[model samples]
Target: MNSFLLALRASPLRWLLVPLVALDLTLILTRDGYWHGLWGDTGAAGQVPTLFLGVFAAAAAAWTSSLRRPSEVAETLGAMPRPGPQAELPRIAVVLCVFLVPYLVGQAVCFAVTASSWPPGFNQYLGYLLLGVASLLTATGLGWIIGRLLSSRWGAAAGALGWLLIVMAFDNDLSVVNGPARMQPDLLEISLRAAAALLLLVACLWLPYGPRITRVSPLPGLTVVLALVATAAAVGNPVIDERHGSRTKACVKGPTEICLWPEEEKYKPMAQDVLARAENLPPVLAKPDAVHSLGLVYTEDRRWGGDFDMDSGSVWAMADGLTMAISAETFAACREKDFKGFEAQLKADDQSVLALERWLEKRLAGGGEPEYREEGMTESMAKAVETGKEMADRPEAEQKAWATATVRNVLGKYCDR
Candidate 1:
């Protein structure tokens, strides 16, 4: 313990820890709220902070490990009354603490910032923290191994670059973009990553302390295993169920109750206004049923860029949720035994559904002719629009009945005999 503390005090690498942690915290504080709102998933919100910590932690570990290059002091320590691994354990413990303590502190600050807005369940938040800690531990192990194997001058740089590449691979993978896995946290993926990290750390512990050997070692076997497991976990499961199911939602009451994901609570007023607008549609045009709630999911694009504006995006998302709610109700009332076939028909007639959406949007904008037309107007859409105009020309009583029937028909609930 004395030797470890002495080494820490003497090491120049210790200085890097503070800057790295400060930079990470700065980045997290600046962007977490926007990310949380954009993804609407707390697990996804953890990615940025974790990625930053992992990359720098790996570099710091490598720098620390490289300082121990097979010196007389190392030899003297190894030659002590204790076994080599036991003798070296305290130094490793110190290194791990140096990297981990700052990381955990940064995580706590990030979590506190997130809690002020999203307030995720305790278990879910802890799970995210654990996932991040596991990632940092894996990076530290890999960095230590790399530093021990390579020259001190180049080891830290190599570790940093290698960890960066690994993170980029996960971030920019084509499968992640094309598939359902949009960088959100999944239990299966996190578990596999943690397992791979553990194996790598174990292998690093077994790494020889002296001169490099020509013969193949158990390290190669461990490396191969790690590679295979990480590859299989990343590529094999292109999609896994996200862990957002456990998140608690905050709700508000009005003519229709509006419930939103925790991160989206800041936009509750906007969401409510959208709902109020939706409710304002004439009952004859399509009175929405009792319930209303927003389905929060990760979104790739925003209507605006720069300075984290969520107004347009949140309003549009709320509108989409209202449309889906009405559709769900219509589908539930559907008597068609072949739901698949019914769904297929509904999709085919989506233009009519979209026309209703356009009409609703226009009404929300204060009942004027829509300034722009939706592109690629299908035959069904044109017919629906013409029918809507004809209904508007009819008497109030007849128009109301027709509008209700039209909405029901569009939703595939009331089929003509």
Candidate 2:
């Protein structure tokens, strides 16, 4: 291995490496599967470049190994190769080109057949190219080191395994984007992080290979493994734990609470207070239901947890909130003739109302608390209950008038103060 490294160091091929690496990288960045899926709308559009990168990286690894094989070493030695970094670098460069051509050709086909546009422009392409080259070179270097440490075949196997692990861990949303073409680019970040870790692993595998021949070594390969593990821990955390499917699942049970799916009727106004206001100036107060019908609205097109709980004082706080949110959306959709937009708004509003109700309920249920005073006419009713028991012997009409006056006074205070 040392002899091979020295030979490579002495070869003229070294300078060609930079350009070959750049070419392969450019090819990968330009290929996009833009229209490959259904409707050409990719929820997973971000991952196309990473997929190409992985393929290129694997091919580059294999080609590099074949070029650096022991047979090549023997032949180079027999030819009395010039002792300079120039000679071997050219061979590495040639190998890189050979590996790159087939990969680039496939990408060309992918581009032509799909007629896809690289989502970003020249600057973005350059950025992706640089990123791809860095990742591939790192993998190649690591594969070279692994081959050296574990005999050629084991090294090749290690390289292949590393590549496979990276591709698998790229965060492809197979579970969701199935059956139709729904591409997403969200996994790109994860793929990039995985590729980076692979590169580090390659570095780790190679850096110690040169120094271990003379000194007593304690597993010269563990450094890369540990580094890869740590990177995975940091970059992979959010991807691994994300509850992607749960975004559509039912999470909210009541009208007053928010969840992915809220329950019915919790927000279906028993009354028609859709705007949360009083109407009917001819003197009767508008029914509370006429304005404050509970319902959920889908605002901003961002799917979130259903409405939060509002009717907490009731035995079924959660259920009530969920129910209200769903019903509200349904009700709004039915009313507006803009069924789609109405449903969306109702869901959002249900979420809002439930939140308000739950907050208010919490305030009302407290002790010596100011919230109790603000709970509409509940205080007045309690006072009425005490006074009514004392006036139990009064005639019905007199009692009714007195009660009416008291109720009007209480509700009037609520309206005025």
Candidate 3:
């Protein structure tokens, strides 16, 4: 116990904590207010500090290992009663303490702050947090192993490079956190990655150093390490999980039935408020029918609901999403109509629908005429934009007439058949 205390005094972690905490808090607080009150994102924010700290942890671990080689320590022990892991693992624990303590503190503070506003549940997805922890352990262990192997000052730089390479290798696969999306982490991918990291850390723990640490053959361990690396390559992409939501938790609000997901339940009042203000706008294209949450799909009609995100809490975002949802409904209905083989992509690139969307957005959000960018304007798209601007410039009756007739005709033409 006293040895641990003594080690802490000598460790650079004593000084690193202040800067690390400052950096970590900055990451947590600097972003959009949308995520600050949310549970999952805030918990994920807990892992943000380690992305930078992991490299430092690796380099520092390697540097410290070079300073205290187990063989040299064994020599110093001479004929002492106990020699191996008892003498060594504790110091490694000290190294882990240096890096992990700040991580833990940052996590606790983030959660505490988020918990005040989000009452129903905690961060349901812990895979990202676990991923962060495993990465930290892997970096520290790998760095220590590198220094042990090199037993030189250059070990620190090598350790940093190795850690960076590992991060890049898993770069596409690492889906640590997202803002307000309904999609959660892929547990299968997360487990596979977390497992691979653990196995490697186990290999590091069992690694035999010279003649002092272990008498086991290095060949068997090397083979095992190779196997683990190959398995890591097989883990699936983490961030590629689908955008999903539970209809069971869906809540319908306001006159148009804007359904939102469970996490978005808190915004129901605000959504209703926004819908009320936009009442002067034309009736929704898919009026009287439901406008489900962004991810809730109706397979029978192949209707992928509406545009929704955490940003819907903002007044402008809510108005924009409501108009987008109505426009999407029009798009979905048009897809059901038949088009010629050559016009198949028409369903995707329909200009009339874009115009309708922009026009409705202008009315609901109270914007000026829709700006058509000449840079990439196709002839048909320019005509569609012109129609939308004309609609926006018209009076309420003309706007409604345009919405029901012009959009209907356009949908019936190419956007439809």
| lDDT for 29 (candidate 3) | 72
Candidate 1 residue 350 Cα shift, in angstroms, is 14
Point out where model 3 deviates above 4 Å. Answer: 68-74, 121-125, 172-175, 179-181, 185-247, 283-288, 298-321, 328-336, 339-352, 362-417
TM-score of 3: 0.74
Worst 10 residues of 3 by lDDT: 206-215
For candidate 1, the TM-score is 0.60
Which one is best on TM-score? 3
Q: Rank the candidates by TM-score, best first.
A: 3, 1, 2
lDDT of 1 by residue, 311-359 (tens): 2333544554555555544444443665454556565665554545544
Error of 2 at 278 (Å): 35
Stretches off by above 4 angstroms in model 1 are 32-47, 66-71, 114-120, 168-199, 210-240, 243-271, 290-313, 323-417
Better model by lDDT, 2 or 3? 3
lDDT of 3 by residue, 1-417 (tens): 776777778677678867777777777677555555555566567776677778988888777766644676656655557644445555577767777887777777777776776733254435456656666776787787776666556888988998888777777344254534465555566666666655655555545544222345677468546745744563434533545456465465656776766766666776676566557655437643555556765445565445555532454455567777666565565455353522554645766676786677666545664332346878888787677766776888878877887556665665543
TM-score (all chains, Cα) for each model: 0.60, 0.34, 0.74
lDDT of 2 at 162: 70
